[model samples]
Every structure is written in structure tokens, then in C-alpha cells.
Target: MSGALARLLGRAALHAGWIVVVLAAAILGGVCIGETAIPPATVLQTLANRLFGAGYPLDRIDAGIVWNYRLTRAIVAACCGAGLAVAGVILQALLRNALADPYLLGISAGASTGAVLVTVAGVGAGAISLSSGAFAGALAAFLLVALLARASGGGTGARGTGQIVLAGIAGSQLFNALTAFIITRSASAEQARGIMFWLLGNLSGARWDSVLSAVPVALAVTLVCLWHARALDAFTFGADSATALGVPVRRVQALLILCASLATAVMVSIVGSIGFVGLVVPHAARFIVGVRHVRLVPAAALMGAIFLIAADVISRIAVQGQVLPIGVVTALVGAPVFALILLRARPAR
Candidate 1:
């Protein structure tokens, strides 16, 4: 017993340290490693000068690049990664599937559909924002899947994974098709090209406003998930077992799902559907911290932030002069890892 406790404490300490390391790495990658590569001392001096009015030597263009573009992209990437990973953690628990993610579950697709409508069709021009439209669409998609699963007698009983997966597949396809149709009909050739880039997860537009809008919601929802860690653990043993333990299974499930979906929609609205952070990060965190949500959630959040920030850096530098879509980078990295995971999951014959 004492040995197990010691191991757990050690893992907890590692998780805490990992958070600091990743956060520092994010800053370094954002400020010192991008195009025109600023020096660490210069980056620190620039920040110090801004905060403390200290005279630090730096060129205006370099300072502008770091402060206005790279740093903002880094911050937004971190928020996006953390938010999506938390959503992944919740959906995996909610649906009882290791592979469940916002994009896989169609939530991101729904958000994309809504954003495309706002941008292309001008659905709510002058009145509604893209973020609001995406949030509504995300909720709609989740509700549609839940209702379909429930109708098919899936969410509450028997190998519910099949039902949720099937429902999600159907809903995702429908929304994605709708998004494509909207783009085709409403967008001009140039507008269609821009929309396609956005849908593929462009972070070139990352700014302070996007970070301000996303981080608070991401932080709040992630904390709420961590607080409910025990309840989520109850879910691992199935709904019947959870009920026997006095957990209001349906209510808690609904609340967490809504929170996760909302965060996902907001992030997707801003960044345009970066996939696999949610799916991949939690699993990686689980390998390090086990399945306890308290440690798992924060670890996954930090790991995700690191993953996306690193990916953003790579996206910018991969092709000499042009930046690639973040979604493309993550998909390239995640697909093989995910496949290997599945191959390992194949039961011994």
C-alpha cells in the first residue's frame, strides 16, 4: 500500500513539473524559435521593457513579429489544445470509448458547418457572431446524436459504444455535407478557397481577441471536469454501477457533455477544426498519470498545449516561406499514432 502511494505521489509531482516545462516551452517556441528567431534574452528584455519600463535593445520589426503574431498564435494554440483535450477526456468518459473525440463525434464538424454558414451564407450577418453560431451548431449536433442514441436504446444500456459511434458517424457526415454544400452555393471561387483553408485549421489569424475569448471558457470547463473526477470515475464501471453508487448518471453526463461540446465549439470557431488533440492527448496523459481525472485532466491539458504549440511552430516552418494548416500537421502526426494504438488494442488471438 505504501509503495503504491509513493508511486502515485511521484506521478503527481511529475505532472506538476510537466505543466511548467510545457508552458515555458510554449513561450520559447512562440518567441524564440519562429521565423526570424528572436534571442531568448532579447525576448525576455522586450517583455521586461513592456512590463517594467526597462530599456532593452530590440528592433521594432522583430519586436512586432514576436508580440503581435507569434506570441498570439502560441497562446491561441495552447488554449485550443487544452480545450480540445479536455473535451476528448469528457467524451471518452461520457461515451465509454477510448477513441471518442470532438471531431470524431461530429461536434467540430457541426461548429464548422455553422461558421461556414455565417462566413459564406451570411446567415447572421450584422447580428450573430461566428462563435455563437458554432456553439449553437455544436449543441445541436450533440443533442441530435444523444437523441438518436437514446431512441435506439444505446446510451443507457448494452454495448452503448456501437450506437453512439454509429449515430455520431451519421450526424458528422450530414453536417460535413451541409458545410460543403453551403460553401459551394454561397461562396465565390476566392471565398471558397479561403473557407477551405479555414476549415483545414488556419491559425494565421490567431490574435489576442481569439485567445481572450477561448482561454477563460477552456480553463473554467477543465476545472469543472477535474472537480467531477470522482463522478467520471464512477462512469467507468458502467451506468448501472454508477447509479448504484448514488451518481445521477444522466444529469452529470448531460452537464459534462454540454460543457465539453461548448468549449470545443468555441475553439473550433476560432481555429477551424484542429483534430486529434482531444483524441491523442488524453491517451498519452493516461499512460503517464493513469485514468484518474484529477491528474489526467491537467496533464492532458498541458500535454495538448505543448503538442499544438509545437505543431504550430512546425506548420509555420515546414515549407520554407508558407505556413501549413495546423489540422494537416496534427492529422499527419496523429493518424499513424492512432493506428498503432488500434493495432496494439487488437486482442490477443
Candidate 2:
């Protein structure tokens, strides 16, 4: 027993070390590869100076861009990716649908509408911040979807799942239409252009403030999901089966779904509606780590973080002297994968 326990501890430590190394490498890559092309050695020097006071003399401008701009953006991107991917895993587990994701509940659409209201419709009369408006809109959309689901007799069953999905679709459409209407009626060309860019997922505005807001939410959501990992595993066999296995079906579902909603809301509010990280990364993680939630959750989070950082890097370099929307890059990659997954999942004739 002692030898087995030691082996387990050693293995766990190894995995943790690997995760840290991979995450650090991805972050450094994100910081180093940009239009300005900061060298990796300088990037390390800047980090050593700021983090440890190593007194490495680096270019002031390079240090400022690395410490203040790229590092913050990379960290926020990682947080958004991890949070969204975890939310996707939770939703997919609860709903027993491979297609379920963070945005399946209309959270993203609602956030967009809220942002448009603040920026275009003047809903808050210039008092409310964009992120605040987006968060409120997300919550409102979720509440409306919940009400609609309940009205349609949704619960923990196949029929319930269908009803909830339909309700989400309805809610998303309603919010999306409202956003389009507001943009068409109220926004000037410049405001319209800016809103469109943001709606398509721009990480250019990410700063330390964004990192401060995102990191806690991502960590909290990941921890909560990990704590309830067993519940999620049971949920894979349906709520009825989970209940039979001594899981408090209703309480677990409510708690986890709420976690996913809040996490999604916070991320969308911070980064706009970047899709596919949630939908694609969870599936990829599941493929790599199998179905156990304990392994799946952390794997998903790690992969999601690295994936988003890479996508952001691609977005920065994809166009000559211009950045593509992060969403476009993700979509361009994810849509084809999504189609392949769907095709493979189709029942054999």
C-alpha cells in the first residue's frame, strides 16, 4: 500500500509539472510572437525582471508591451478558454448531447444584445460599463430560457433535454434579433463596425483589468466542476441513473448548470462571444483522456487554454499588418471539425 501510494503521488506530481510546463510555453509563445516580434530571450528577461527583480536590462518598450499588453492578453485568453471549455463539458454531461456547449443556452447571444444595448441603444445612459451590461444580459437570457424550459415541462429526461434545447434556441434567436435591430436602428457606421468586430471576438482590448476579472472566475468554475466531477460522471448515464447511484440529481444539476452559466456569462462579457473553444476543446479532451470527469475536466481546461492562446497568435499573424477576429480563426478551424464529428456520429445505414 505504501509503495502504491508513493507511485500515485509521483505520477500526480509528474502530470502537474507537465501541465505547468506546457502552459508556460504556450504563454511565452503568445507573448513573444506578435507583429513586433519580441525575442524569446528578451521575453524571459522581461519576465525575470518583473516577477523576480532579476535586474535584466531589457528595452523599455519591449518590457512594457510584454509585461503590460501581450502577457495580460494571453492570460485572459487562457482563462476564457479554460472557463468556456469546462462549461461545455458540464453542459454536455448534463444534457447527454455532444453538441451542447456554453452558448447552447443563449448566453452568448444575450451578452451580445446587452453589449449592443449599452453601446448602441444607450440602455444604461452611459452609466453602465459594457461588461456589466453584457453580464446582466446573459443572466436575463438564462432566466428567460429557464422559464421557457419549465413552461415546456423540461426536467431530467430525454423529453426534458429536447425541450431545454428548443427553449435555448428560441431564446438565442430572440436575443440575436434584438441585437440586430438595435444595431441597424441606432449605431453609426463607426460604432457598428466596432461592435461587429467585438461581437466576432476581439482580444485586442485585453489588459490587466481583464486578467484580474477573468482569472478568478475561471479558477472558481474549474474547481467547482472538479468538486462535482463524480456527479458529472453519473450524469453521463442520465439523471435517472445518477439518482439511482445516490446522486442528488436536482441539486447537482442546478448547481452545475448555474456554474456553467455564470462562467460562460463572465467569459463572454470579458472577451465577447468566442465560440468553438467550449464546443471543440471539450470533445478533443474527452477523446484524449476518456470519459471520466476527474481526468476530463483538467485535460479540457489545459487543452482549451493552449488552444485559445494558439488561436490568438494565429489571429495576430494571419493577415498582413492586420489582425483577424479570433472567432474567425476558431470558426475556420472548428467548423470543419464539427462537420466531421457530425458525419462520423451519423448512424450507419
Best by lDDT: 2
Writing each residue's lDDT as its tens digit, candidate 1 over 1-349 gives 9999999989868867877786877767666887667888877777777779898878988777777887788888888999999999999987788878998888999999988878788897659898888998898888888788778888554457878878888889989999999999989999999889988998899888987998898889888998889888888778788899999988999889888888888998999988889998888888788998887889888888888988888888899989899999999998887787778668998
Residue 129, candidate 2: alpha-carbon lDDT? 85
Q: Tens-digit lDDT track for model 2 on 188-295?
A: 989889888888898998998889889998899998998999999999999878999999998988788777877777777777788888888888887789999988
Could you tell me the C-alpha RMSD of candidate 2 in Å?
Answer: 2.4
lDDT values for all models: 0.86, 0.87
Cα distance off (Å), candidate 1, residue 129: 1.6
Provide the clashing-pair count of each candidate structure. Answer: 0, 0
Candidate achieving the largest TM-score: 1
- Model 2 bad stretches (over 4 Å): 1-10, 118-132, 150-157, 346-349
lDDT of 1 at 204: 91
TM-scores of all models?
0.92, 0.91
| After superposition, candidate 1 runs with Cα above 4 Å error | 1-18, 155-158
